[model samples]
Target chain A: MTDAVERIVNLALHLAHAAKPVGHESIRRDVFGYPKDQDEAAYLRMFERDKDELRAAGFVIEANEAGLYSLDSAATFVSDVGLSATEIAAVRAAGTAALSDPSFPFAPELRLALAKLASRFEPLEVPAASRQADESPSDQAENAAALELATRASKRVEFVYTNSIGRTAAHTVEPYGLFLRDGRWYMVGRDIAHDEPRVYTVARMADLMVSGARPKSPDFSRPAGFDVSAFIRLPFQYGDQEFSAALRFDQSAAWRAKGLASGLGVLRSEGDETVWSVPARDDAALLRWVVENGPGISVDAPTELADRLVSTMRKAATLHG
Target chain B: MAKTPASERARRLLAVIARLESGSEIPLVDLAAELDASPTELASDLETLSLCGVAPFTPDEMIDVFVVDGMVEVYSPLPALDRPVRLSMTEARALAAALQGAGFSADDSLVQRLEAATAREFDAAQAERIVRAASGQHAKGVYGSLAAAAGAHRVVTIDYESAGGAGTSREIEPHVLFAERGAWYVAAHCRLAGAERTFRVDRIRSAQENGESFTVDAADAAPRTATPSGDLPTARVRFDAAGDFSARDWPGARLVSEHPAESGDGDIAGPKAVLGPLEIEIPYAGTDWIARRVVARGGAVEVLSPPDVRAAVVAVAESYSG
Candidate 1:
C-alpha cells in the first residue's frame, strides 16, 4: 500500500494534470493510495483528508457543483518576479543562516521554503552567518510550538508561568501573537482567568499544552487590530505610571537614536542635536539607559527628571571619589 | 520513519519534484546539500516518488524519476509539477521572520521583493504585525554593506562611533558577521587597531566598500572575544539592595558576599523590600567598559577596591554631569 505522503502527491498530480475536473470514481480508480477492496466509507474519509492536506500545502483544489476536482494552476504556481542578484543573495543568505539556527522558531518551515526557491539561483559562495549569543533551545522550541497553535492553529494554550517577581501560577491563554526582544521571546495573549490580554515570557513557562479539540477549527478569533509589536515595550517602558521623557543626543551620537528608539518614540532634529521624546515608566531604568548609552546623551526635559539624574551622578561621583 | 512527519516529507518531495522536473542530472550530494537533506533521505524520497502515479499506475502516467550512479535524473517529466508551488502561509511567515532576524525590517525592499512570490492568500501586512523577530530599528544599509563586503572578501572604510561618543574612521577587511545578545557585530581585521576586532554594526555610522579585495587569514578570520586573556585586573564592587543587579550584568564576576542592608546605608525605593546588598569581584580587560556600566547603575552600585577603576568611574560620572 502506498504511504500517505505518496498518496497525497499522486492525488495532487492527478488533479493538476487532468485536462478537466475529475470525478470521485476516476480519482479512486486512478490514484495509487486508495485500495480497491477498501470499505467505501473509509476510502471516502481518507480521500477527504488527502484533499485537505493538499489545500494546506498551498494547492488550490476546486470542486464544481458536479463534485469534480481540478487544481487551479493560477493560484498554485508562483509567477516569475525577476528577482535581481542582490535580492536573491539577501534571501539566500538570510534563509540559509536562519535554517541552521537552532534558536530560530521557524527552522522547519524555513527549510521547506528555501528548498522550494533553491532552483532559482546559483549556489552562494559566502558562508552563512551564525548566532553566537546565549540561547535556551528549550525556550525556543516551546515558543515555536505555542506560536503555531496560537497563530496558525488558533488554539488556546495552558501553561504555568513564573512572573518577574518569582510567582508561578497556572494560566490558560488564547495566544494572539508573538514577538522577540533582547534575546527573549514573549507571547501576547488573552488570559482566560483575567479575561484580559497579558504578555508572558516564554522562558519562564512550564508544561505548556495547546488545546487539542477541533484540530481544524480555531478555538478563538484574535481581536481586530491586535499587533504583537505594540506589546514589545522598551526596557524603561515597563511600569504603572507613564510620563513623557525627553533626551538629547549630541551631534556626534545623534545617529544612534533611531536604532536605540526601536520605533517607539518621536525623534526630531534640533540643529546639531537629536531630541527624542519617549514614554518612560521606570525612572531608574531610564537614568541607567542614558548613562549606559551616553557620553553624548543627557536628559533634556522635565526639570525634575534632569535634576534627579544630576543628583544620581553627583552621588556616584562622590562614592567613586 | 515515524519520527519525521508525513506532511514535512510531502513538502520536501514537492520541492524535489520541482527541482528535477527540468530533466537535468544533478549529483546526489549536491542535491542533498541544496535541499538540506542527507543523501540517504533523498534516495528514499526518490524511491517513493518513483512509485507515485495516478490511477491504473500506468508506466506513462507515473513519475519516471530515479537515481543513477548517485545522480538524480528524470526521464518522464510531470508537466503539472514543473513550476514550484507558491509558498504556504506558514512558509511565507517563516521567510519574513528569518529576514527580520537578519536585521531586515518587514518594510525592507528585500522583503517586499520576496512577497511577490508568496501565495495570493498571504497577507504581508498581517504577517508583519503578528510575528516580529527584529528587536530594534537597525541600520539596515550599514548591515547590508558590511554583509556584502564580508561575502566578497573586500575591505571597506567605516566611520564607527564607540559607546563613549568617540568616533574614528578605519579601513577593515570584513570577515564574519554575527549577532550577540540583541546587536549585530562584524568581526573584522581593523587596520587602525592593528588587530581583529568586533564592531557593532549599529554603531557604524557609514560603510563604503573601497573596491579593494583582500584575503583573510585563518587566524584573523576566527571569532575573537573582546575579553583579553592572562591575569586581568579585577574590580570589587557593591550593589545596593534596591538594585536588580546580577552576575549576568557583569560577565566573569564572582560573588564575594551578601549582607543585610544597614539602616541609613542608602534610600530604598519600589515595592519589593530590600533582601540584601551584594558584593562582587568583577574582572576587566579595560577600565572604560566597566566604568560605563558602573556609572549606568547610578548610585545603586558603587566601586570598592581598585582606585584606578574608581577613578575611571568618577571620570565617567563627571562626563555625564557636564
Candidate 2:
C-alpha cells in the first residue's frame, strides 16, 4: 500500500508478466536481484509484492502446489462486457431486419453477419442511444443515408473528424470496428492524420463519404497484445495491486497456456511445465484467471500471489456449490 | 438600355429588392409600409435577391448585394423573377439520371413539370435517353405507392417474396418509405409480427392499403427513423489502404496498428504465410458480405476482430464452404 512497496511491486509485476512462461527464479531475481543472507521471509515479502501487484494490474494469477503460475483464458479475454444473450439477440435481430433497406446497401458479407448474429441471441432491447436516435427524424435519415452509402460503398471509407474541442483531423481508414461507446456509436480506424490509429464517434461526424478507394494496406499490426477494454480504466491493465505473489501449475496443463496477448511474449516449452510471466495493472482479472484455469494453472513466483488465487477460487466454488 | 418589359411578379419583386438595396436610408419598416407587403415577406425576398448576383461580366461588376439590420436587398439588371428558365434539357436529364440510379424519379409534380416544359415529342439526344436510363417512370411508381401508404397510416396487405422466394401475405402499418440501394422500402409497424419492419417494394407482389388515415409526423421526425446501410450488426475495420470495394472515400481515419496475419507472418514475400496482411479496426455493417469480399480479394485483404467477430467469420466461411 505504501508508495515504495507499490512501486517495487509494480516493477516486479510488469517484469513477471511481460514474458510468457517466466521461471520462478527469474521472477525472484526480477524483484530482489540477489537475496540478502538467504532470508526466506524477505523472499516471501517479494512474493507478497508480486501477487499484490498482479491483482492491482487486473491479472488473475494462480499457483499450483508445484510453484508455477498461469493466466486464465476465459477471465481475461473479453470482447464484450455484461452483455446478456437477450441483448445480443436484439442487436442481431434488428440488424437482420433491415436487410432490405435500400438506402443502406449491405453486401453479401454483411448480410451473412446479420443472419449469424440473429441466430445467436434474441433481439436486444433498444438502448438509450438507439431509442434517442429514434426520437429524431433527422437522425434516422442521416443514419439511413450512411447505411445506404456503406452498403453500396462496401469498401473502406475515409472521413474527416473534428474532435470535441473543434480540432480538425482526417482519417483515411477502413471500416472495421463499430460499437456504441457510452450511447454514441464510434467507428474505429487507423487514423490517417496521426498515421497511428483511433476511434471516431458517428454522431460527431459532419460528412461521410464512401470513396472508390480500396483498403490499401499497411504493414502494421495490433501487437497482438491489445485488449479493447483496457481503454476503460487503468486498474484492468497491468498488476492489480502492490505486492508480489507466487503461483504454481501442473506441468500437464502447460499446453493450455497459449499467448493471452502478443506482448505477453513467448510460451517457453520446457520439460513437462510452462511458466507465465505477467505484468498486471489490476489483480482481480488475474485472480479470476487462476480460479477459472483451476488446478492446471497457478501463481507460482510470489507466494502471496498463489494464496490469493487459491482463496478466491475456494470462495467462488463454495458460493456456487 | 432597351425598353424593359416586366411581368407582374417581376415588377412587384424588383420594387421590393430595389427599395432594400437603394438604402434610401429609408427604414425597413418605412419600405414595408410604402410597399404594402408585410415587412417579413419583403425582407425575405430582399434577402434572397441579395444572394442572386450576376457572375462578374467585367472587373467593375461586384456582386450586387446589400444587407442592413435584418433586411436583405439585391441589385441586378436582369429581370427580378426567373425560375431557371424551366429546367434546360441538360438539367432535366441530369435530374432524371440522378433519380434513375435509385430507380425512382417520377412524381405527379415531376410529370406535370416535364409535360409543361418539354412539350416536345422527344429530345432523344440528351434528355430522353438519360431519363429512360434512370428509370424515372419506374422509381416514381414505387415511390408513390410507398408514399401513399405512409401518408395514409393504413395497414396495407402485401404479397411478399424474399431472396429465396418464400412468399407470404402480410398486412403492415406503413409509417415511412425509404429509398435505398436503388429500391424502395416501406418502414412500418408489422401488425402480424407486432414489431417495426421494413418491406422492400420490389419483393412485394401486390400492395394495397385499406381505408385508413394517419397523422403526419412532426417535421423533425424525418431523419431519426432512417434505416442503416445494412441490416446486420456493424463492426469497425480500419484499413491500411482502401481496397477493391470502392464508391466511397474515408477521410476520418489516420493511422493504423497492425501485424502480420496469424498464420502468414512471413508469407507476403513467399509461400510461408497462410494468413495475409492485417490492419486496424473500423466499423463495417455486414460481415457476411465482407467475408465473401475478403475471399474474393484473393489474399489482398484480411479481417481482424476482438474474437467473436472472428469466430463469426470462421463460421461463415465453413458454412459457405458447404
Per-residue C-alpha lDDT of model 2 across residues A1-321, encoded as one tens digit per residue: 222332332233333334355445645544323354557777668666655533332234566676766553233221222334322322222232233322222222223222222222232321111121212324433543453334223455556677767797665654433322222344545554566556565655655766654534322343233333223221224443554433344453443354222224334555677766655555665554453233245566566655554454333223222
Instruction: Put down candidate 2 lDDT per residue, B1-322, tens digits, no spaces.
Output: 3322222212233323322223234456645543444667556544433333222223122224454775444444432211111222322333333333333323334333333332132232333221122211222233444444554355577766432224577877666544432234566666677766656555565666666654445431143222353333434443334243221211112124444434322212211212222343333333333443333222233455445555444443332222
TM-score of 1: 0.86
lDDT value, residue B250 of candidate 2: 17
Runs in model 2 lying further than 4 Å from the true structure: A1-321, B1-117, B121-126, B130-140, B159-170, B178-187, B191-205, B212-216, B219-221, B224-232, B236-276, B279-322
What digit string (tens of lDDT, one per residue) describes model 1 on residues B65-100?
889999998887764587888788888888888778
- Specify the poorest-scoring 10-residue window by lDDT in model 1 chain A: A125-134
- DockQ for all candidate structures vs. native: 0.55, 0.01
Question: In candidate 1, residue A230 scores what lDDT?
Answer: 88
Question: How is the predicted docking of candidate 2 categorized under the CAPRI scheme?
Answer: incorrect
**TM-scores of the candidates, chain A only:** 0.86, 0.32
Error of 1 at B106 (Å): 2.6
Candidate 1: C-alpha lDDT: 0.76
Chain A only, candidate 2, TM-score: 0.32
